[model samples]
Target: MVQDTRELNRKAVLTALMMSRPASRKWIAEASGISAATVTRAVDQLIAEGIVTETAEIISESRGRRAVELDVVSNRSFVVGVDLGASNVRLVVADLLARPLLALEIATPTATTARELAHWLASTARTSAGDVWDRVEHLCVGLPGAVSQQKRTISNAPNLAQIEAPTFLDDVENAMGRPVGFDNDANYALLGEQHFGAARSASNAAMVTIGSGLGAGLAIDGRILQGDHGLIGEFGQLPVGPLGTRLEHMVTGAGIIRRAAEAGIDLAAPSQLFASDAGPALKALRAHFDQALLIVLTATTVSCDPQTIVLGGGIANSLASTLDRYQAALEQNLRVSPRLAPAELGDFSGAVGAVVAALHKVYADLGIEEEAFVSLPGGDALTHERVQAARR
Candidate 1:
């Protein structure tokens, strides 16, 4: 009974710490609804366990008394995040705080199988983690598919070449000797942006990722709105064009390439599609952009009603100059146009989201039930006001 009480107290304190940044003992006590003495004792235990660290000293302006601010000691554990795009695999090794210590990207061939790709990602993550490899507690892979809500299955990644009994998650976990987590790439990208980038403060936002494939991640009321099947904002399959061509097929990097080819522009790679010297190619790209932007804007206005729509992924960055044109087209069509902006995190959104997921997992394992950051409330009148302002 005594042991259980101590454990509960520790958990409460940890949860309070996770929710409040640079939290002091007083703040932890207040937030956790625990006594200051209990918080002090629990914090000492956490520090001894090396899970928490004194980040800085906070001096009170009035009293001039200094209090030590505590934060999660990142290096105590680490997580590996892998974003396996259709044409490339990007890996990031991050500490518990989600700060990337190292990153790597590699080209992936069309024929790569789930097992082979998992092995390569595991090896690369281990290599990038260096001496801290042993400290890695989790591995999260953001793939282009529908991850089962139960977290045991990945389905509907037609581009990955449907495999028979392919256990990519198991293979990766086995290789790294750590627990693995999985999510749809777009969903992870949304979380990454919310945790570390432009939409960090927004309550309702949507991220459209245009890469070899296309998808969207939605955050409503500050929580990632995973559907019943953990596939909420899958905009790729949304029928926007004739002959069953979905939004993804009409707007992604591959789509741009196909459109350019249709216009008699021969492009060897999607990266080369945006070169300034390719004048005819650029013209074709612009036409494709206009069509794609129209679809995305129409979809955003009708579906999520987001305050902000962030454009991200490999193709979005390469064509940053054309963002104005896309936004203008969107505004011209919509009654309440959402704020359009470039993704602040670029390609690192998946990795950062993986880190956030890992940290949440860590808190769960430690029996801490608290949010690590402020989340926007969906039903708040303030949120509606903000959305109205964004439209302006």
Candidate 2:
């Protein structure tokens, strides 16, 4: 009948099936909160379309007719996540459920043209993913800078200076013969936390990353807020302190070394500075964190009041021992305190976010609600007891 799976009942049925494999129509109805007739109708259509398969038969609890247990045919489709960084490129291929089938990482070549990058992507997928490449239904690319309006251009990435050609993204899409989505790497990292890490319950969150440079990914009302100019959540630009040091300068790896030098202390790395309990460098680093938080978190908290604030990147993760102080400092300064946590996913957050973005596109293309696929973490996700306790 070529029925579209957009109906609420169909979505419910699919979601129930995804959650519990090989379930009967009656079980799907109970789990999805849909009537048995609606589940049966949806299942029949899904099975016919090969989206779902009759896996087994079970005796009906009500002793009516033999119940046919149905499950999603995950192997029928695939999603691909490509993280294109200044230093490297990461590709992960997965089934419809976003379970990793293949993962590969390679140093990024100096490809000045988007067409070159596109060809590389296709070739790499074919070589690494093998027969699975044919089933890749959705793809997402993550990059260090903003994706322009309509996702046609990449901008503000100094590392990729040669990619000024506006036709780059369009050409890439054409080469691939399918739609392509772009994820700003900063926002994608935070989105990774929202879907799979600490910010699962946060409808609004500020994911601050202290790395080579500082930036934030703001999740507002369950969506990432990219500004009109694709500059939203660029918290690095926020200038604070007596000398007007920007957040980027205060919270980054280089910033730590530079600030410590000014204090007449030679610290090899953040790890070295964090090694001592009482030292001039340690005090300076703590002050830097405090000053930056006082400015950034105050502004972020009062403006948006994000339910949770997640901290990530090189500096934050490196200072694992003193993270409690970081959170406590935020609590001491802000008028309204929000939950604070460290990122669970470390280097691979952006790659995972690319996968989530690809799956999101798949759901939209299929006219299915997010509840049906849940490619990313949602508020309803079950988290570790310690994580939940820490948030409160």
Candidate 3:
């Protein structure tokens, strides 16, 4: 019992340092609610393990007491995070502090099986990681599907169904020669925003990605809200209208192209669906787009009651001109509307989010469960321009 109590106190001390490092022992004890002597003992043990280290910088604590600062040994290891989409894979190599050291994007190989895809992702990530590859302690690949980490399986990924299988994660781990993690891409996007993007201050937030397909990632009480089987945010299939048409069928990129074709509009790409002309076909397309988006926003607000709703994915950016309309519609309808905003990270939200999750997993592996949220330090460092600049 004493050992367990001491271990708990150690974790508390470590967690306190993890959240806000370069802190004094008195600050750690106060932050963790652990006694000063216990915190000192735990810090000593952590220093012996090379997990925590005393820094040269010192600070004046309460009553003018001078003490040395301490911090986590973040530079000792690295991790790789991949946002594996159907068309492209975005990878970022980050340190234990969740700061990006490198970022790259590559076309996803047209592999017909999960095994082949796993090999491709592993090799591609290794190449992308470059010099940091050797110190890479963990790898996390976020997929555009419902991921069951416990079962080590992926499902409901229509665009990349070929990569869905029970052993997919194990296959990637075997090929990568390191521990690998998997999760829903949208969930990672939410985490990215919570850490580095617009939703940083929001405890209850939702990230709705309107790209090739529609999906959502919800966070409540500052944690990813994954229901049974990690399927809490599959709001794309929610039906609408008297015909009971699925929401994704009305809002996705493909859906817009198909509808445009049916309406006698020759749309070479989904982006072309939003032309300046207010002709019959274009007007119809815009109306349908607005209505579908409104339905999604309303449903999300009603269900989750998130403090902020971040609109993301490729399509969301394209619909920037119509943001005011959506916000107004929600205000008119709901008693308390969520603060709607565009995804601040632009395209790299998922990739950056994947890095954050990998670091969080590292903390979890170290038994720091109470507070494991990680973030890239400077807000401007995680901006779309900075990430794009790092991309190969």
Best by TM-score: 3
How does model 2 fare in lDDT? 0.69
User: What is the RMSD, in Å, between candidate 2 and the native fold over all Cα?
Assistant: 5.3
Over 1-392, each residue of candidate 3 has an lDDT whose tens digit, in order, gives: 99999899998898888777779898999898999999999999999988899987564745776688998887777888899988888898877776677888778886658899989898888888888788898888889888876677778888888767777788989999988878899998888888888898888899999988788998888888876576778878787843888888888888888888878888888877666765787887888888888999988887678999998888898877777778889999985678888888877789888887787777776768544553334245455766767777
Model 1, which residues run further than 4 Å from truth? 1-8, 20-23, 30-33, 53-69, 109-111, 156-158, 162-165, 228-230, 263-285, 373-392
What lDDT does the true structure give each of the candidates?
0.71, 0.69, 0.82
Worst 10-residue lDDT window for candidate 2 reads: 383-392
| Residue 238, candidate 3: alpha-carbon lDDT | 80
Residue runs of model 3 more than 4 Å from their true location after superposition: 59-65, 241-243, 372-386
lDDT, candidate 2, 1-392, per-residue tens: 33543466677777767666668888888887787777888888778777888878887757567877787787888877777776667676767666667666787776546678767766765676678778888888777666675546767666665454677777666777767787577787777777777877788887776666666778777678776556776666676645777676776677777887887777787556555564765876777666775566666666567988877766667655665665676677764577777877665567667777887787666545664443342332222222233221
Which candidate wins on lDDT?
A: 3
lDDT of 3: 0.82
Candidate 3, residue 93: how far the Cα is off, in Å: 1.0
Candidates in descending TM-score order: 3, 1, 2
* Number of residue pairs clashing in candidate 3, backbone atoms closer than 3 angstroms, sequence gap of 3 or more or interchain: 0
- Relative to the unseen true structure, what is the C-alpha lDDT of residue 143 in candidate 3, on a scale of 0 to 100? 91
Please give each candidate's TM-score. Answer: 0.82, 0.81, 0.91
